[model samples]
Target: MTDHSLYVLLRKLEDAKIPFTLARDRPDTIRVTMHLVGERTEIDVFDDGHMEVSRFCGAEDIVGDEALVDRLIQENRD
Candidate 1:
């Protein structure tokens, strides 16, 4: 089975009630788009664990630091 870690990560967004979608495709190449509080953006994560973050708006308005975002994105299965 494919690792459920990413799917699990996506599920956390559900409790937050953030809208998202999962498709059957190569993950690293998959494009994810999101709008957080009217800010438009997209993020594509690479195989090396690096992400390309783009924001049409609202990047500057993010609260806290990168560490917070990292913590939120990490899905702990233990």
Candidate 2:
């Protein structure tokens, strides 16, 4: 969570009714527990929602599109 990237992401998630947990105490961590894209997976929405918790060093390995991330985040919202 870098300067309201969390806020923006959170807004999206909350809008779509997606399930997510927010920990502002940790800037590098955003925890989300839910089934997304396919199977059950946990994702750590990072700056611009570019990180995934399921994969190791996912930032370098996995790339999450902004729109998809926004939509995904939104999906978990209310």
Candidate 3:
């Protein structure tokens, strides 16, 4: 994603009290992932501002924040 968008996302996550880590995926790509109680969410940001998010959950259902996932998906997609 664009630098602005990524910054906004990081701010949102911080505001929501969600803990995540950012790492370099490629020369022009960044990867952000959050580790929740029983699940994980990953978002990959590209230099051109495109993004893709994936959620991984265990067999049991969870009560994590759905709004955050929705916002991420809505904001970042092909």
Candidate 3, which ten residues in sequence have the lowest lDDT sum? 1-10
- Segments in model 3 whose C-alpha atoms lie over 4 Å from true places: 1-3, 59-78
For all predicted structures, in order, the TM-scores are 0.44, 0.36, 0.66
Tens-place lDDT per residue, model 2, 1-78, is 545555666677788887655544367677665434444445676656575656332233356678889999888997
- In model 3, what lDDT does residue 78 have? 84
**Clash pairs, model 1 backbone:** none
lDDT by residue (1-78, candidate 1, tens digit) is 444444444556677787755333464655456657667556564555455667776445558798887887786535
What is the Cα-based TM-score of model 1? 0.44
Which is the better candidate, 1 or 3, if ranked by lDDT?
A: 3
Q: Model 1, poorest ten-residue lDDT window?
A: 1-10
